[model samples]
Target: MSDLVARTGRLQQRYEAGCRLVAGCIPFRYRSSDETDVNSEKVVEVLMINSTSGPGLLFPKGGWENDETVEEAAVREAIEEAGVKGDLMDFIGYYHFKSKTHQDEFSPEGLCRAAMFALFVKEELDSWPEQARL
Candidate 1:
């Protein structure tokens, strides 16, 4: 069994102006289009995790807690959800969305503002907190 465990609950989650703060990243890697080609073009491949509630895939993301910076939260979510670790490359941008299904005490309206980043994946773990679900 994996020793890693994903964070749960929103007791320390950050919120502002009634919007829950989230942090996430697009985990990517570069692959050579042709292994035999000396000058093969590099292709960008993104890593996505299976959604627990449905059939779609999604980037790793979760609540922005008070104890950690946005970058830390993003990286943590990547490790927890996608079982990948890497160097956080660039700040993509903030995305705003609403989720009635996610409504909670910290975010009564389920409004969320997610800070997104670009992560260059360095390692893929054999097992992670959510690997059983996958």
Candidate 2:
């Protein structure tokens, strides 16, 4: 199968219950700076991917697959969507969001829950899935 098709397949695999469950990460890196203090000397920059289906930047995220743990799923999403590999840091928290297109019989409000993680990016691909990033 084509890369795009495989990616779309992974992203579109929702739970049969219609309850949207997802995994994602906030990928970030620290750059050396001229500042003095150890804490302040590193400039932190977070990676944001251009939304393929809508406007604005977004963290790499997608549907949770039955075959993988939440952390694994989050890491997979980051690699596929942002082309970044990183250490999975602390479990940040869960976020509940709503989308008009996501509404269904099980989730009338189109509500979705995502388990978010903090990923300290170690490597960035020279060429990622073709899309804008910030």
The candidate that wins on lDDT is: 1
Q: Candidate 2: where is the Cα deviation over 4 Å?
A: 1-6, 10-18, 35-40, 103-109, 129-134
In model 2, the Cα lDDT at residue 71 comes to: 96
TM-score of model 2 (CA atoms): 0.77
Tens digits of per-residue lDDT for model 2, 1-134: 11432245434445544568889999999987865566657789999988766788889988777778999989988887888889999999988777546666656777788899999999987645543433
Error of 2 at 25 (Å): 0.2
Model 2 local distance difference test score: 0.77
**Backbone steric clashes in candidate 2, count:** 0
**Which lDDT tens digits does candidate 1 get at residues 1-134?**
56899988889999999999999999999989997896999999999888887778878888999999999999999999999999999999999988646888867889999999999999999988878888
TM-scores of the candidates are 0.94, 0.77
**Residue 3 in model 2: lDDT:** 40
